[model samples]
Structures are given as C-alpha cells and as structure tokens.
Target: MDHIFSPWRYAYVTSRKGDDGCVLCGIGAAAPSSDEESLVVARGDQAFVVLNLYPYNSGHLMVVPYRHASHLGDLDAAVLAEMGRLAARAEAVLVEVYRPDGVNLGMNLGKAAGAGIEDHLHLHVVPRWIADTNFMTVAGETRVLPEGLRETWRKLRGRF
Candidate 1:
C-alpha cells in the first residue's frame, strides 16, 4: 500500500456544493436552445441525456428524467420507461461516435451510494476502452480523458 496524490481534487473534495435544489431540475428547466450550455446531448419528452461534468471517460453520459425524483421507486412508469429508452439511445450514440471497447451503465441511488446529486436520480453511461484505466489511475489516482465535454456533446448531439 503506497500513497497516491491528486492535489487537483482538493478543491472538489472540500468545496463541493450540496444538493440543495436538484441539478437535474436546473438542466431540465433550461430552454432547449441552451442545451449546449447544459451539456445535453439528447432531449426526450420525459427524459434527457447530458454529459457528466465529472466524467469517468471521454464520453461519459447520464440519462435523467425531467421529473426530479430521488429514488427509482419515486419515478412513474412513463418516466422510468423513458429513462431506460434514453439510456439505451445514449449507449448507442456513444458506440457509434466513440467506438469504445465496452460501456458501463448504472445508477447511484443515494449520497452514500456515490450520487453527487443524490436528490435527482440519474443513470450513468460510461464508455470504457481496453486500456482506459492505466497507470495514471492505478499509480496516480487520476483519470485522463482525451476529449472535452463540449466536444463530446457536439459529436453526440446530432446523432440523437
């Protein structure tokens, strides 16, 4: 066991904002014309797909329902169904645009479960390559994403 440092994360760890009013709610409330500013790649009637501000990989995305719900059980059937559909669409878009070796899809239900915005439930779609997790992560505890979020948004937005 050795020590690895990521001093860049100090500000994030200490200054992280609390989930007061849901971030998803703010994104959902944003006008469609401002989708790019919100990092939204796709917009559906019930749900939408946006890039994760803190991404695991270049094409990391989240499928979130417009309805601000904390838990899966809190969402209605329509929202739940649309969330699944949007997640699938997001994966498809990522595959076509990124061509990653694999994809990870999941949901963190609460703060203790690693949900940054625990008040608004969202599904994560992270793209994974064969060697995506390399020495940087193992030795340095850092992730290197080759692409920027705005660029990723541009690549996937039209595909949706």
Candidate 2:
C-alpha cells in the first residue's frame, strides 16, 4: 500500500470554500514578489501563463489575458492572438520540463461549461502521458501528481 501526502493542498481546499473575486485578475495584478506564491510562470504584454494551483496534472497551466473578460467575444483581437502565442509557449515549456506523451488544451466559457472561475477566461494547458489516468482519480476521487506546484514553477519559470 502507498499514500500520497499533499498537506499544502489543505489550505487551498479550505480557503476557497466561499471565496470571491476573479482569481485570474488577482494573479494578473500580483507583483513580482508574489509570483512564486501565485504560481505565475510567465507574463506577456497582453496575456500571461500561470500554473493551476489545483491542477489536474503536475504541469497543468493556464494562459490568460490580463483583461477581466469572461466571454471570448469580449476580448480584443490582439489579446486573443497573444493568448494563442502564450499557449504555444506553455506547451513548449511543458514538453521541455515534463516530457509528457501529449498535451490537452481547452477553455471553459461559463459555469455550465465546467469553468470553475467562469467570470475570467483562461485556456488550460494540461500535459498528459500514456496510462496517466488511474484508479486514484476515478475510484478514489483523488489525483496523484508527480511533483509539487512550486517545484514545477521553478523548472518552468526561467523558460518562459
């Protein structure tokens, strides 16, 4: 038998119980000193790349525009373009650092669409490998990530 200890996630799970405000906007507004804590990996002029604090995988990242817009129709063409560019960069960084079998990229437009933070638009860059999904996630309702978010940030931060 084996056990996975992720005590750091306790704070996140409990703290977000009834949290308000747009998380993406808050991260965008955070200062450089807060990068590690916020899990922001890279910042661009129009958009930025950040790690999902409660990630599906070890390198699950999100490319988000700085503007606080929920719908894709609300974003400017430049912001949309930059988001794509940043997604590409994120994929490259994930490949370089994690070397997964493949990657999953997507966006959830609204709460009904499975967007946890439906008020802020973000594209998820989730790295995947063969046989990565297991009983832990399906049967136990638990995710087994290979590495911690902070360590993943350290590996990907300089690359972006």
Candidate 3:
C-alpha cells in the first residue's frame, strides 16, 4: 500500500493565482500580522511577518515586502532595511518562544533557485536547534514536528 500521510498538520494556502496579481501586493500594508486564517506574525509599514502555513519548523515564517518584486536585486533599499528589522524581530520572538539553538534565514529566488513560490520574493526565517532533524527525514521520509502549528502560532503571536 502506497499511502501518503502527514499527521498533525494544518495548512493555509497562501495563494494559487500569480498570473496578474502579486502575492505581496494583495496582502496590503495595514493587514493584521496574524489572522486566524492567514497566520501572520507581525505587520510593518513596508513588510509583513507571516508564519509559514506549511513549515519546516513550527515557528517558520516569511518576512514579505509590501511591493511585488520578482528578484532580490529589484527590492527597494527601504524594504531591504525593513526586512532586516523584521528578521531581528523574528529572531527575538523565536528566542522568547522556542529558544532554538540557531536559525536559518534565506530567500530562494526564482524556480531554478528552489523557490517554490518564485513570483513572490520573500525572506524565510526558520528556527533551528541541535537534534531537531531526526531519523524521520533521514530514513523515514517524514518530519516530526515537536509542536502543532496552532500552538506555535499562539505562543509566537503573543510576542508581537
């Protein structure tokens, strides 16, 4: 029997349309950082912090700019600075909540660069720790998340 099962999961599809609309543009500048549906962490004037609805780690989040830019080089300087600020805030929140030993901050540009959603340029902040990766990934082809998304969102949302 070849059955795929992802236990203990909750996901919010960020978007399915990218033909004419920009993922960053639709979310807006004044939207709540985390809505029950959207799972946003914090919102800034030029940036938005959102929990990765489908995450590598429970607290995984993306800091997205308000403007829609396909490439990293196209980002405005102000948005870049704001991204840094949001990154710092994300680190602080993760420390306060998960207290992970480390974190991974990155942006995968374009489809060739491993960007699953290439049209939306966003920075990913994934919390990490020693032994966080287990046999599930190495041998079982699965991941064991220590906490659920809702619990993580509750803990993280309180910080901001």
Candidate 4:
C-alpha cells in the first residue's frame, strides 16, 4: 500500500494547547497583524473568517463572533446578522478561489453535537466537491488535502 504523509498534522494531533484556552477566542483576540499566522482571512465589525486548522477541505473556514458565546441564542441580532454575512462572504470567496462543486454551511452547537470547541459558537463554511471524500477517509481514517493552510489563506485573504 502507498503511504500518504501529512507531517503538518503531527503538531495538531499531538498538541495539548486545547487545554490552555478557547482556541476560537484566542484567534478572535489576536492582533490583525497576526492574521496570516492565525489563518484569519477576513475581519468584520462583529465576526471574522478564519481557515480551519484541521479542515475538512482546502478552504474550510469558520465565521466566528469575537465574543465567547456558547449558544446561538446567546448572541444579539447584530452579531448573528454579521456572522451570516461573513458566512456568505466566505462562500463567495471559496467559490472564486477553489471553484468548488458545492459548499456546506453548518454549526455544531455543543459537545454532543460534534463541536470541537463547544464554548464558542461559530458557523462553518466548507467547500465541497463531488467525490471529495474517498477511500482514504473511510478505510484509512485520514483526509488528503491538495493544498496547505497558508496557501489557502493566501488565495482567500484578498477576496474577503
């Protein structure tokens, strides 16, 4: 069998930083100058778009409000509206940059609902294509991405 290597994921899979603080909140609080390192592509008044560190696809992004809110109902109308706007912008940018066959927008609300970060509510904007999932994901329990995060951030940063 041929081996598919993704050495970058080693840091993610082995890191204990998830115990330090809320990752989303940390990214939200980071300075604008650090956006590239943080994988943040766009910022708005209420929400910002950042590429997923462990993405389902090349351009998988999350639109997160700066505030730490566990649930959607906890947010005010303006924040909610801005999150929606950011998600829309993310979709447009993903289409323009990746030419995806389709896109998936979703939110995993809590630990029971598949949220990796349960305390911070964020909307996911995932670029999808036909046959994007293959045997590697099912048989090997791994995902193969054609591009890296920095490249994805570079391609999407200016569009948003």
Candidate 5:
C-alpha cells in the first residue's frame, strides 16, 4: 500500500481538539510581519485574503472580514463590498498563477450549511481544473497537492 504523508496537517489535527477560537479572526488579527506565516497574501481596508490552510486545490484562498461576523447580514455594506473586490482579485491572481479552467467563489453560512467555522463568515475562492478530483479523494479519502503551502504562498504573495 502507498502512504500519503502530510506532516503539516499533524499540527492542525492535534490542536483542533483544544482550539476554540475563530481561525479567521486570529489570522485577521495577526501582525503584518507574520503575514507570510499566516499565508495572508493581501489586505483591503475591510477585508483580507489568506490562503486556505487546507485547500481544495492550489491557490485556494479565503476573503475574511476583520470583524468577527457569523452571517452576511451581520456585516456592513463596506465590508461586503471589500470582500467581493478581494474575491475578484483572488480569482485574477489564481488565473495568473495556476491558470485553472475555472474559479469557484462561495460562502457556507452555518454548520448545517457545511461551514467548518460557523461563527465567523468567510468567502472561499478556489481554482478548479479539469480532472482535478481523482480516486485518491474518493477511495483513499486523501488529497494530492502538487505544491507545498509555503511554495504556494510564495507564488501568490507577490501578485496580491
């Protein structure tokens, strides 16, 4: 049997049990000096772009508001507008960096709606390509990524 090793995920898997804070809010509040470590590529006045810790594909990112808000209606117009603008920018950056066939932008509002973080809202920007999904994800329940997170962050950080 072939084994897929993702050592980086160990930290998340181990720490998740004890973690009660909102991940998005923590990233949003992090200092600019730690942006690279946090995988934050860009920041707008009301929102910021950070790479998804676990991505569906390469260049998967999230646009999150600075304020902690669980629902769309909880945010003001300015925050919503900036998140949209940032999501658009993320799409452009993904196209330039990965050149995927298409892009997906979405928001999952609550636990019942498939939100991993139900208390803080975020917009997911994913880059999709032909045949990106494969048997490993279906049968083995594992994801195969071509590049490492730091490498992905390096490739995308400059463009944003």
Candidate 6:
C-alpha cells in the first residue's frame, strides 16, 4: 500500500551481481571481512560470519571457516565447532532483534544439494517469520523485505 525506497532503486538494490567468477572468493578479497558493509559481523581464529549477499531473507548470514575448503570433511574440529557456535549466535541475535518464529539453519554440501557456492564450505542461517512467504517470491521472482540491509545489520549487530 505504501513505499519506503524509490521504485527505481529497487532493481539496483536487490539485484545480485552475476559474474563469471567465484562470488565467495571475491567477497573475501573485497574487504577485510570485518566491515559491516562487507557483511562480516564477527570473526574468530578458525571461522567468520558473513551475510549472504543473495539472501533468502534479509538477515541471512553465512558462518564459514577461515580456511577455504569445499566439503565438510575438509574442515577441522575447531572450524566445525566455530561454524556451529556462530550459527547458534546468529540465531540468538536474529531472534532477539526480529523475533522470527523459525529459522532455517543448515548448509548445502554440494551443487546437487542446493549449494550455490558449493566450492566453499559455509553454513547459512536464515531467519524466518510467521507469514513470511508470499507471491513475490513464488510469482514475481523476488522477496520484498520490510527493512533495508543496513537497518537490519544495525539491529542485528547490537546482539553480537
């Protein structure tokens, strides 16, 4: 019924860059992985937290190990524990801020398993709310979010 951002900016804002290279690797190089704009919330020795640029939801973040490996077997115990801990932390933060009714916490191992970036071992933490699904995603090929990425980041970062 009402609008927040301009309609003209919507395409550019929501549009994901479809280049002929590895997006995950590019993200790692683009910034220090600690900047909020880079979508890196918090990081430790073995792993780090990064927001999924192409997200299922606004607060969708990826908990990934510092080491670049494709499969779960490649990750060590520390890295695995780091991923698990970060996932739990992300869930708590999202719950505290957005109060989502449910969460989609898991990782797609391979391409067949729906791992968009299968080459990189990472876990996705997607926040889900009641009545979040709609025709926009099903029909319009989009997911209209209520808040901007910066706004969502600001709210979620406080919990970290």
Question: What TM-score against the true fold does each predicted structure earn?
Answer: 0.83, 0.84, 0.78, 0.84, 0.84, 0.76
| Full-model lDDT, candidate 4 | 0.76
20-65: candidate 6 lDDT, tens digit per residue: 3544544554446446666667766677777665566778778878
The CA lDDT at 89 in model 6 is 92
Which segments of candidate 1 are over 4 A away from where they belong?
Answer: 1-20, 135-142
Tens-place lDDT digits, model 3, residues 17-69: 23355545555433463264466667777888877765777688889887778
lDDT of 6: 0.66
What shift in Å separates residue 102 of candidate 3 from its native position after superposition? 0.7
CA lDDT of each candidate? 0.74, 0.76, 0.68, 0.76, 0.75, 0.66
lDDT-better candidate, 1 vs 6: 1
Candidate 3: list runs displaced more than 4 Å. Answer: 1-24, 28-34, 135-142
Task: Give the C-alpha lDDT of model 1.
Answer: 0.74
lDDT string, candidate 4, 1-160, tens digits:
0111121122332322234476777777778998998888999988899887877778989899988899888999999999988888888888988898999888877666677777887887888888776522633434667888999999989787
Per-residue lDDT for 18-90 in model 1, tens only? 2445567777777889888788888899999988776777888889888878888888899889988888888
Per-prediction RMSD in angstroms?
5.0, 5.8, 5.8, 5.6, 5.6, 7.1
Error of 2 at 105 (Å): 0.3
Number of backbone-clashing residue pairs for each candidate, in the order shown = 0, 0, 2, 0, 0, 0
> Which residue ranges in model 2 land beyond 4 Å of their true spot?
1-20, 135-142
Between candidates 3 and 5, the lDDT winner: 5
Shift of residue 86 alpha carbon in model 1, Å: 0.8
lDDT of 5 by residue, 1-160 (tens): 0111111121332322213466676777777888888888998889999887777777878898988889899999999999988888899999998999998888777665667676888888888887776522523433677888899999998787
The residue-by-residue lDDT of candidate 2 on 15-134, one tens digit each, is 222234556677787777888887889999999898887777788898989898889999999999999999999999899989989998888777556776777788988887877766
